[model samples]
Target: MCGIVAATAQRDVAPLLIAGLKALEYRGYDSAGLAVLDGGQIRRVRAKGKVREMEALYRADPFPGGTGIAHTRWATHGVPNEANAHPHVAGRVAIVHNGIIENYADLRARLQAGGRAFTSETDTEVIAALVDERLAAGLDLREAVLAVVRELEGAYAIAVIDRNAPGRVVGARRGAPLLVGLGIGENFLGSDAQALVQVTHRVIYLAEDDVVEITRESVRIHTLDGTPVERPVHESELSADAVERGEYRHYMQKEIFEQPRAVADTLEARLGPHGVLPNIFGAGGDELLAKVRGLHIVACGTSYHAGLVAKYWIEEYAHLPVGVEVASEYRYRDAVVPPDTLFVAISQSGETADTLAAMRESKRRGYLGTLAICNVPESSVVREADLRLMTRAGPEIGVASTKAFTTQLAALALLALQLAHQRGLDADRYAGLCAQLAHLPRAIEDALALEPAIVALAERFIPRQHALFLGRGVQYPVALEGALKLKEISYIHAEAYPAGELKHGPLALVDESMPVVAVAPGGPLLEKLKSNLQEVRARGGELIVFAEGEAGMDGNPARGALLRVASGGDFIAPAVFTVPLQLLAYHVAVLRGTDVDQPRNLAKSVTVE
Candidate 1:
């Protein structure tokens, strides 16, 4: 989950590299470093902690050059320390890499046998050494990089600087993400387009195994095999404001409040007089949905939770069996493959490793077709899938997802309606669901209005050690998501169980000190869920319920505590209910004084498995 930013320009490139790294800090890194070719030598600085430390070091003693590469590393091969940080230099070459090199030990041994000295405990250093060795053998910077990449294995997106080639930076990618930003008389590279948005809005995303050579006045793209290639430069639609934190204390909070607008944006063009548009998922999607015998979803983390919610929607509306699995586990197992099952892959950043692999596996095993529900349009997952539904939530900066998840649910809701419509469900019923969807943005806004009350409730949870979330029917996934948010940001131990499953094991953990959160939407299952809450209450468990409509528990002492969030419809309740939980997590983390945006041991997009 490392971040890479490199630049070759007419002016000093260190400042631009620093700004790019700052833009990518939300991806979560443990260390930062930079390398610049100055005075025919690779000058480098590394810091074990935040980018600010690296910035301070650079301000004190800057490494100024026309070309440079920088990295914010989330450690994998070695500990997070100055020695283990990136921009690993060897001889005249400095390299910053993302993703692990699978055969580094063998490469390191070969290099050591060649009498090459290593200064850092990193596979990246081995890469630099190999490249330097190739350079020593009369290969130019581009050729050296290409030669070394052929000998390496596993995912990597690397930027290399050769002191011999003063004004150029060579970058190559395989499994990890890398893109080039186009600017007048300059060129840029970043692990994410966000890192380059401030400098240039035009970008070219590199395909796997594509190598790029960048200079102050020109850029050339080629395959790893040395054949020239061309890639389209698209004008990025993301504004600088989307990635900035304005009034909110953290990006997570800003994202939480952006859900209403996100959902509104996602619903655009998908709704009309015809209920749900048949072609919202792109061409031929309606026909595929009409023919599929079953549905299977593959995703990881928050996307998986979104899939869990989609399971209920698809099964209920489309009258088709739905199965959901964690993408990591799904790819490794010998699971049953149903014929004509519609495969769906969901991710906020289409670069999630496990999810992308699972999508490939599903496609290989012969599904009806694959659909990618993702936020970014040109992501790997969307590019490979047969049909695509872009969430259009824009850029999600926070590690803990908010707008992305809500927008994903909105997209899946559209899919569910399309399936129902094609399955010959009642026309009036479909139109009614569309009407409810039209009201979702406003309902999310109303739920956001309940933030103050949710914040007050969060203060009560600050000192608690554990929390249990409960819901029945479709709200079960909502409960799971709420628990995930609490545990992820606040560092509180939390678990979720279906209300009916309480007696199986979770009920035993209930006590006076434990707070039990219930997603009580007051549908047919409300009375049953109340009975489950009574079991918790009987055990002296403190109760917090996010109720929809009047559950008769308002101001009732038996309920312990209640917060009402606007329930647009049961179809849209997941999106509405998510607002308060996100608020609760934000407030609790703030109260606990934890890092709200970048949580410990987590990255925004899991690029490496």
Candidate 2:
């Protein structure tokens, strides 16, 4: 993923563009650059590193202009370096792009055959050069952009500016996020709302195949064929303070403690008296629920683990046969998704490349209907899905994801109950689960208070290079998510295995140096989980056992630390058990002095496949 920001203003736009880029840097920070029109020519400056490096470069030799485009790149086709940075220029035209061009090789060959020279090793530069070549053949800027788009393939959100057009900029998107911010005497364009939050909260989300022409005074929208179209501008609910870290030491920790509030917010509009679930999907949900032959849950990373947990809830409560697949691998497998099958795509950021692609594939094959459980409103997944369930986790900044994952589980559990209700499952059973769901936020609050013990354990084990996470039943996915958070931020080699699977092969890796974090809540799987923990202890692996209430094992206080989470029923236990693991990972990463917000080799959003 990469970040792009463009502005056309009556006054100097460099500072505004830079500030916007800084806000969007969480998307990508491999290299940053800006291109501005100066004295009838495109002037550019770029650097490979953090945004601060580029800011220093700009201050040293500024690009003077009232209109410009900027980018923070996460390199895809080229290595991260100054030369590979964005704002790739050709003649007097400059371009900054996010998303991949699948047919760049063929397009580049054609351009090279036409004697067009390239300055950088980027697919984006190809777009710039193609536009320049088209303009050289007497086509205007808009026509050239249209022609180049016709020749290009794959996903892209591109913003281009030409010195010839002066204070004008053009942008288009296909499979990536792009928004137009409306302001007085100026208009802005960026990959997301974060970039424009400082300027305005009024935004128009650009749809696929839509092109926008932005001028200093106004923004005009049109289809690829130059047909005028009306796009609705909505006021963003995002507050400037929402993006701040507040009193927390890091965004990760803030997000960890935000779980209780996030879960409560997600349940706000979906629940009523007596724990009744709202009909979010409308009457169509009834038809889809009735015709469903099977349920397929598709997602990636932490969302995938959430889906694994949903599979348990859906099958157990709704009595539906369920299949959980990683979104990236799901589309390629030979598994049959019949016409009556219901495909549920779970993604915190609805723009996740693999999950969106999987949704498209499911629709192409005529699945009954596709549903999206997403955090961001107006995201591509939410727009394309036949149904939507929005999570109110509000802007999870940490790359490892804390609040979003828990909120997704909360929403999905509600969905599972709603489906069970529609399926005519026993009313008392569904109501009991709903009552448990209502207490989850408070359970999470009690769970979060165990941070001191988790932090102490983290201090003891942060230097360790490897760890193992174990759980049984629904808690297994919590184990996976915990291991994922540790590995993602701490750069530790962590593995999550089902407690039953430990003796199969993972037992060989156990030792004194390896920490075994087991989810041993008092549930149906407690005895099996204890057996697994005993196996690890017998192998001399350090134990970090998370259980409910006071249940201490004998004579192993030093070698092992036990966290007694506030007791909850089995239905809500996963939500409670998740908090301490999140804390442990956050503390470990902090103790190791890792970049928790923008982890190495990762971006907040995965906009590319």
Candidate 3:
């Protein structure tokens, strides 16, 4: 479940639908398709690969369809092929769906028993058949969707268009994200605001269990029980330029370079003469964070790595214990949570299925309050949270997530610093930490300056099949993030372990052929990390170290790739160190001719668990 775009407008919405699909391409899809109710009938076009292919197919012989729906599919229920591509049609109805229909197998059997043949193996097709069956029973489009959805179980967002009802689209979301874009003589539906940015800025964020029916002039929403409701129309801050790749070779590279500005945007208003303002999180935010005794940070992928780094910052600065967990695992198995613990959920999209579920579960598990550190303002996690701190990284169109990661660190750093001040930590030390954080934007800028060196390092990784990353203390999470970037974009197998853990078990795999990347930011653990690097050197492992220029690599022996970055001190070191690793991954992927922005087998947002 990845992306969906639905629109009914005065003009031909085929191009609009296709553009929306292309805009969501960063979410990673193996197939794409669109269905338009053209000329009093439904016409379908599906492609087995990128949206560009489908656009090419559509444009080869364009048609005037004033109403249409489209989707970019990240395969879950079936193989990646045209047959399984979205806009699944049954009878006169066509639909595009995101999220799992958990009871699809049973539904499919039930439908098959009724002698209805299925066209696709997707759970979505079963949904289409049910809706079609309801319509066949003389139910209207809205009633048909409501009846079918009531019989279904699991998280889902669906957009259905019927050939009999032109210039209208019916959408419902129970768990996944779906929204409506409002415009004169046009209205829109999208999984994310970015999808509708090209069409309109005004959007109505559909809440859980909300069903919406949109015509060219009006939008009517109802609950699954058919109770009428009204959703707020938010003027999205996302500009068309924010989602475009300008000057940079790819969105990933653009986002990597944008980190300096991104981090600055996140930290600017929050930090003042007094320190981090409590209001930056939300209104009355201080009440939520003030009495926190501990934190239970939950996230997935890159966000999880950020949480790992935050554990160190909070414990070091605020003198508070922190527990970090993978969101998917945390919700499934929980033992105990101490009193006065703040539940923190961090995500770029703020719509991660696991993280959202974990945060919801934590509410019942007794936490002080829930805070969402997210990039998207209108995302579900932010809306459902007791407090929210926006990263202000703008729109991160890259699937690999460069600016979003750094900006999240910047936000987390602010939280840690604010908590430190609240706890009456040393005045001078707190000020120093604030200064380091303020200098983070420039530090990230300096780090991006090392791209030429990272490019040279990238050449070394071109032929390598595997790599290793090492760090100590807070940098261990940076190491983990570095490993993730290399593996995700370059498709090289990479692993990260604390430098001290080399001898424990991981060192057995190190050899002359293995490239070991060491994140050697200047800190108290530098000496210990140096010793660990020597262990790799003695074993003939190719040593690649990213260190601060002040961290004397001249005296330290372990070497291969010694790249120096601007030192932001340990307080903001994680954000600075992340830049070069991101660039290295980008260049390495470019050299290998791999997709950098839309990495294979990965989506920009994990909407499905």
Candidate 4:
């Protein structure tokens, strides 16, 4: 369940729907399809891979309907095949859904027992069946959706069109994101603003339990219980140009190169000449920091790696004890929330299912308050959290996050600096950290300049099956992130270990067959890290070392590979080092002929558990 696009227009909406689905393609999907209510029947086109296939299919035999629903599905209940794709139809209804339907088995059994036949093996198909059953029971399209949603259990955002009704679309959201796009004598619905960016910039972000019906001329909203409601319309600043991959070969590469500008955008105005302005987290942010004695940062995937780095920064500078945990695991355990401990959830989309659940669980467990560090300003996490820090990463369409990860680091750094100042960090030291934040953009730009070297280095990783990454202290997380980048894009099996923990069973796997990539930055632990690299070299392991501006390797090893990242002291090296790693993965994937932007078996955001 990944992307959805539907529209009711005065003109032929097939091209508009196709364009919307194409815009959401970066979210990652294995199958794509769209169904238009043509004349009195549903016309369908389904393809197993890219949206181009379906678009071509539609071009050969066009169905000129003013209303349609489209989907790019990342298979949940079935395999990635055309038969399992969305725009699933049943009786009078055709639907596209994004999110899991937990009670589908129960509903499928009940429907089958009642003589309703099933086709595809998707939970989304069950939804189509349910909505069709309600429609057949004499309810209108909107009523059918409201009734079907109440009977359903699980997270979902569904858009439906009745074969009997023209110029209309019914949409409902319980967990996943859904919004209505307003236009002149036309309206649209999609999973996110990016999908609607081509046709409209104004939208209504649907709240949980919101059911909306949009036609060419009007929009109506209500709850599952039939109570009428009004949702605010938000004018989106997102543009179609932001998602285009201008000069880069792939979205992953483009986003990797965008880190410098993205980080600068994140830190813009958030830092003053002296230090962090503190109010960047929103109004009353300073008072919120004053009460915080500790932090519990919860996130997942690359965001979890960012949280780990933030723990190092906040503890080292603010003197605050920080506990970082993966969001999926944080809620499963009986947490011990210490007094004045702020619960922080970080996400690029800010709609990660596990992180949101953990944040909710934290409230019941009694934390000081919740803070959301997110990229999307209107996401659920930002709307629900007591405080917020928006990471201005723009739209990170690639599944293997590049600029988003670095921007999260940039945002978390500001959070750390603000807290450090509250702990009475020295003026000179504090100003130095601020100065480093200001220099991060140039440092990243320098790292991006290493692309040719990284491109040459990619040839080495293409033939490799596995990799080992190493770092020490703050850079340990950097190593983990580097390993993640390689494994994500190149599909190379990789692992990371603190340079201090190489002998703790990881050393046994080191050999000439396995390359060891190390983030060897100049710091107090540089000597220790160098010794660790020596151990890998002794084991005959090929070494790829990213040193800090020629400082870590004075007498360079003739047998090893070395690339330098522009250093900006110790405060912002993590974000800087991340650039080459992203470039490394992108180039490796390109050489290996892999899907660099939409990696296999991965989506941009984890909206489902």
Q: Could you list the CA RMSD of all candidates, in the order they appear?
A: 1.4, 1.6, 1.4, 1.3
Model 3 clashing residue pairs (backbone): none
Query: Residue by residue across 564-593, what tens digits does model 1's lDDT show?
Result: 777878788887888888899899999999
Q: Tell me model 3's lDDT, rounded to 2 decimals.
A: 0.90
Q: Write the per-residue lDDT of candidate 3 for residues 1-609, one digit (tens) a residue.
A: 479999999899999999899899877579999999988899999999899999899889888888999999898999999999989999999999999999999999988899989878899999999999999999999999999999889888899999999998999998799999999999999999999998899999999989999999999999989999998889998899998898989998988888889899998878987688758878878877888999999999999999999999999989999999999999889648999999999999988999999988988998989999999888899999999999999988888878889999999999998888889999999989998989899988888888887888799899999999998999999999999999999999999999999999999999988999999988789988888988988888888888875343454354476877767787888888888889898899999999887888888788888
Encode model 4's per-residue lDDT on 319-413: one tens digit a residue.
Answer: 99999999999989998888999999999898898998899899899899999999998888999999999999999888888888999999999
Estimate the overall C-alpha local distance difference test score of candidate 4: 0.89
User: What does candidate 2's lDDT look like per residue over 530-594, in tens digits?
Assistant: 77888988878888888873334664466787777775789888778888888988889989999
lDDT of every predicted structure (CA atoms): 0.88, 0.87, 0.90, 0.89
Listed in order, each prediction's TM-score against the native is 0.98, 0.97, 0.98, 0.98
Q: How does candidate 1 score on lDDT?
A: 0.88
Alpha carbon lDDT at 287, candidate 2 = 65
Worst 10 residues of 1 by lDDT: 550-559
